[model samples]
Target: MPRCIPIKEIKNTTEFARIVEESPEPVIVTRNGREAFAAMSIELLDAMRMERARAELYRLLDEAEEASRDGRVVDARDSIKRTRDRYGL
Candidate 1:
């Protein structure tokens, strides 16, 4: 479960920093009884970003595989030459 904190409690930067650093879960900041923001450690944020990126990469790979199976594929050498000619590379 996430740790919930009122916006008012954020005024104490030291305590807020400590909570974010020590807690394994994200700190949910509420405004007027509704969730408004989330605070998490840098490591957690980076890991989440990397995981999302990996998932996206896998999705793209799957899409490419389906395209290849459907005969909507290109030769790597031909594609590279076309790209080079288009870009004057």
Candidate 2:
């Protein structure tokens, strides 16, 4: 289980850093007797971000496949040119 700490505990920077460094699980910061946010290592954060990005890419690919099946797809070169023209690139 993750460690829970009050918002006030964040005031002690040294202690907070120690807890984060020593704990493998994420630290949950609570406020007003409610769960607020989680503090996690950069490695964990980066992995989560990469997972989300892969999921998003898969979703876009699925949508593009559906569009292609529906004969609503555009040529890649024309699409790029149109995008460049639209954005004044």
- Write out the backbone clash pairs for model 2: none
lDDT per residue (tens digit) for residues 1-89 in model 2: 99999999899989898887777878999999899998988776777899999999999999989999999988999999999999999
The residue-by-residue lDDT of candidate 1 on 23-79, one tens digit each, is 888999999999999999998898899999999999999999999999998899999
**Model 1 stretches astray by more than 4 angstroms:** none
Q: Listing every candidate in turn, what is its Cα RMSD in Å to the true structure after a full C-alpha superposition?
A: 1.6, 3.4
Lowest summed lDDT across 10 adjacent residues in model 2 is found at 39-48
Write down the TM-score of every candidate. Answer: 0.85, 0.66
Error of 1 at 74 (Å): 2.0
